[model samples]
Target chain A: MSTRELKHAGLNLQQTDPKTHEEAESRVFGFWVFLMSDAVLFALLFATYGVMLSGTAGGPGTQNVYEMKSAFIETLLLLSSSFTFGMASLAMKYEGKASRISVWLAVTLILGLGFLGMEMHDFVKMIGEGATPERSGFLSSFFALVSTHGLHVLGGSIWIVVMLVQLSVFGVTPAVKTRILRLGLFWHFLDIIWVGIFTIVYLQGLTP
Target chain B: MNQEDRAEYRRELRSYIIGLIAALVLTAASFATVHWRLFSAPTGILIAIYLLALVQIIAHFRYFLHIDLRKSARDDLQLILFSTMIVLLMVGGTLIVLFNLKSRMF
Candidate 1:
């Protein structure tokens, strides 16, 4: 199908069932609003982190705690997952084949899981080195920010599994498509936040 | 299904691949700048990294999120811009006040 045909398909759906199309559009817009609010939350955490970056209180600072290699790997995993999820969305849009979509989704899920595993390992290592949140203000903010992002990833991973199940059970219903699209936005949003974390928290901390 | 559709799909896929490549290259540059000590001054390195990060954020937003300046995206674009403004005001103001107070105390 050409782009025109795709557009026509959408228009036809809207013409036939205006209610569903309107609902989907509003649902997407609502999700965007939610994402913006989430962004504000992250921004607040980042600001708190910036304030406490040096408040080690005689404890381990970021330089002493962060491992650049693992952080880099985590970055790669998350970025690749974002791309894979994009592929999943494309498959859904173009091929409209549930199997193809599931394959890409599975790849994304694995990458996401890998990222979370690496992050958890990093946290364990930090804790092993006595870099717990209670050690200092800096550690407190660090854990809060990083763990919040990690929790989002965990939630997203769970969402992916749920989506896979839904895809298998319901096929490509309008509701499922809307849900998947929102999930894609959520996944990409996390990656964007990770860019900030790596740049501000890890890279900057490791610089000097 | 048809030739024209296949061509459209290819074009879309190509754009996504381009985006992925750009993001990866930017990420590599970020790591290399620090690992190789490309910039001697810490401040300079920080600035470069921040700039690189800004670009990468835009890349992800444009490619993966499909956020553009097109008419259809206007509402989302406005929402994002407004949220950013609020966040900057709140976070930036808090940091400035708190940091200034800390400096004054010591």
Candidate 2:
């Protein structure tokens, strides 16, 4: 690969030859592959959920533990945050405004934290009501599926913070810019998974 | 990226927001339908509602997530479709097999 190719691959997209786009393209391509791999992990968890769905041992089934109103509110927050994050990415990459991107990122981060806060409260309430993960196999799967998502959101929240700090220090450097792009993908991808969780794990659990 | 493109992008964002709200409402209605027994229906109707909500979820992905097949990386959609098929088989097949086995063997 020429210096031009290496540059687009996160070396210097702003100044390099446009034909050297494979590096930037490859970064996204690699991320898509990673997303598919993640789908496999989710598939496994989903299967596990299906298999153990009836193993509730008559102890507070999904309907008993799941709170639709709270979940609805949580869904609203995350979905809106995903939208805002998309706007931040647009501002950063397309609009090329450092401060505008930062503002959007801040909003996204606060919404994410709010979702996490509410989820934590839900979990505490579940356990307090004796529906802890150890209560049954189904509970175990439920906690696994939902908390895995919660942890991912928490990680994404940290990532956004770091990116903001980098933005202030580096001022939209290509590296930071590329990272924000990937993070946008990551954030939105989590919201997509939450759509599944809210439907299958939360809603179906409430079903007879 | 310019004034017109920015306007177009905002339009898309607004649509995404609208779809997101619809998905949320549909999901909530589905949940409440089952929990409070909001209507007179059997499991079949509930299952249909569930399927409808799932469609809305896919809608969210299409409009909000923007995961079109064209933008997918090489073989990503192929693998997802294949894996989804396998997931369907494993989940559905097991439900049938185990229920049958539970009845006969037990």
Candidate 3:
């Protein structure tokens, strides 16, 4: 396939080695299937959240618990990390330098970690403010949706560490390259979901 | 690779950067709508926020995930469209049913 065609198909064209291109293409396509299904899961959670938005049970409402500044910072961190991961993929494909890829990956990892840290602090602050999930239905769904996304970010972070190790030990093999491309898709997909969360859950909550 | 291939790679990289900028701006707008109360009515603000989010989602899908309606991506696009349909049905149904039940109980 031409580079443009490959990109259109959502497959990275950086790994142009004829031998493994076919396998990588199928693998990435399969991963996309998984991601679409995952989207359904998040959609369901979001729906549940919408249903429970008013179920405060006399507990603290969204305005009392949500911190807009923290949420905004988290958004910036995750979005920037997505951009950095794209750079990592670019380094892997265009530069074809394992060291350069590793550098970008490390930067992405730090940004991911920063996002998680801020999220954890936000959760702690909420709990400290008596906004525990068990305190009300609204809080329950809030925790469920946001925590599920957090778990996904945690999983992606672990995968990044493992991939970094793989890169060092195995170098930029076809297998590693394909894995990085898939990770990039997964990371970007999570950011898309976060946009929904911050807009629907946080921004709407703070709107008055 | 040839010079043409190199140029294509550069173009792809630039697209990703552009996507990053667009996403950031959308996020900022979402925050601004809430913080500044750009709209006097709460419902108006809500509608604006949702519209902004929908656009940002499409931006991410096209620029970051590279899923588009081009010939090569037709299958993937079909799958996404189908999944979106199911999600809307399920989620919309849940809201209607549950909200109706709550109203009846009250």
Per-candidate clashes, comma-separated: 1, 0, 0
The candidate maximizing lDDT is: 3
The DockQ figures for the candidates are 0.62, 0.33, 0.75
Position B101, candidate 3: lDDT: 98
Better of 2 and 3 by lDDT: 3
Span of 10 residues, lowest total lDDT, candidate 2 chain A? A3-12
Model 2, A83-137: lDDT tens digits are 7886786576456668999999999999999999999999999999999898899
lDDT of 2: 0.74
In the range B7-81, model 3's lDDT, one tens digit per residue, is 878787888988998999999988999999999999999999999999999999888877777887787788888
**Candidate 1 residue-wise lDDT, A135-190, digit = tens:** 99999999999999999999999999999999999998778887888898899999
Estimate, for each residue in B58-103, the C-alpha lDDT of model 1 and write its tens digit. Answer: 9988877767776667788889999989999999899999999999
Determine the TM-score of chain B of model 1: 0.93
Instruction: Give residue B73's lDDT in candidate 2 (0 to 100).
Output: 30
TM per candidate: 0.95, 0.83, 0.96
- Model 2 per-residue lDDT tens digits across residues B1-106: 5675566557656666776667667766666676677656657546756676677666665665554455333254565567667767766776678677767976
Segments of candidate 2 deviating more than 4 angstroms: A1-16, B1-15, B18-22, B35-39, B69-76, B89-105
Query: How should the candidates be ordered by DockQ, best one leading?
Result: 3, 1, 2
